[model samples]
Target: MTYKGDVTVGGPADVHELTDLMISKVAVGPMDNNAYLLRCRATGEQLLIDAANDAATLLTLIGDDGIGAVLTTHRHGDHWQALAEVVAATGARTYAGREDAEGIPVATDAALDDGDTVRVGQVELTARHLVGHTPGSIALVYDDPHGHPHVFTGDCLFPGGVGNTFDDATAFARLIDDVETKIFGALPDETWVYPGHGKDTTLGAERPHLAEWRARGW
Candidate 1:
């Protein structure tokens, strides 16, 4: 289950065996949003992130393993297009950032704030509230003792730059600062970053260019 260095991003729908966790990702809907199924090997308990779109496809991916919970990274419509359908079908508990919880049509069983933990079997993911993308947009941190940590940055931090701030300077600043302090500064360079869309990147690859991203004002 141990992996060396960084993980290589796969195509549209694929599963990556990362340490003790198995991550299955599928790009769905019109936006090409990524829906990830994270399964803990020890207890076989699982959690689904985004549930972005394509209910039929998401159900097929869920199969019989049964998702213990579904975590919505933010309240963005594109990110939760299939949320109701998926939750209805799976009967899984719903969790989201407290501030943005009202934006979603579905009721969240639990409101996850920064420092709150979501348990998937034995794995405990720490919630990091990264503002700007959405007031309560959060990234779940899985810090493995033996390997680099894995952070699911939902539309807040991306490969080359921070998520779009919709031309708001203050929001952009907040996102970059949070990423630098909460993500980059806290985790090692080998930490794997899985964003809301597109390919993944390691901290090491994006670390040196933080200044560049800041200077360019993206």
Candidate 2:
């Protein structure tokens, strides 16, 4: 498969091949959340990003390889519905953004800060904390050496606009600012974005609309 990042709940996953890592994207739950299983090519170690929902499907995806960590993008209930069960089954360490750790029901083994590094075997993902979607929402950035950078942005970002802010101007501002500075400004246009819900997009594809997203204050 081409790894288009298009998936439907209960459908088979779309796998992306890279030199050192393999990305398996599967959509789960009623909300249609996307859960990614990142497997390190060398060590065969894997790390699951967002155990969003459907433990049975997620477990079956894990197979016997297992995972080292389950990092929640935010404290939102829909994003971590299967965390407890997935963690229990794999005995994987639980990680969440430092500020959102208290909000998550599972005991967080590691409370990540802005630039914390989470490893999946030899592969590493840098945590970028983008506020607004939730006080402690974090996006995982994977800079594949052989390829372009990839970001697992939770609800903070999407294809057309940023996540819903409930019309809160302050949160909207913070989110947009962080997104521009931490995401858009810092990352190149080619950075591939894998969001929490819906289809995927690239920073390049979304850069032109930053002003519009800010102007609308969404």
Model 2 lowest lDDT segment of ten: 1-10
**How big is the positional error of residue 88 in model 2, measured in Å on the Cα after superposition?**
0.7
- Per-candidate TM equals 0.93, 0.99
Per-residue alpha-carbon lDDT of candidate 1 for residues 50-69, written as tens digits (9 for 90 to 100) = 98888888888888877989
Give lDDT for model 2. 0.93
Q: What local lDDT does model 1 show for residue 33?
A: 84
Error of 1 at 49 (Å): 0.4
Off by over 4 Å in 1: 1-12
Clashing pairs in 1: none
Report each candidate's C-alpha RMSD, comma-separated, in the order given.
Answer: 2.9, 0.7
Top model number, TM-score: 2
Local accuracy of candidate 2 as per-residue lDDT tens digits, 1-218: 57799999999999989899999899998899999999999999998889999999999998898988899999999999999999999999998999999999999999999999999999999999999989999999999898899999999999999998888899999999999999998899999999999899999999999999888888
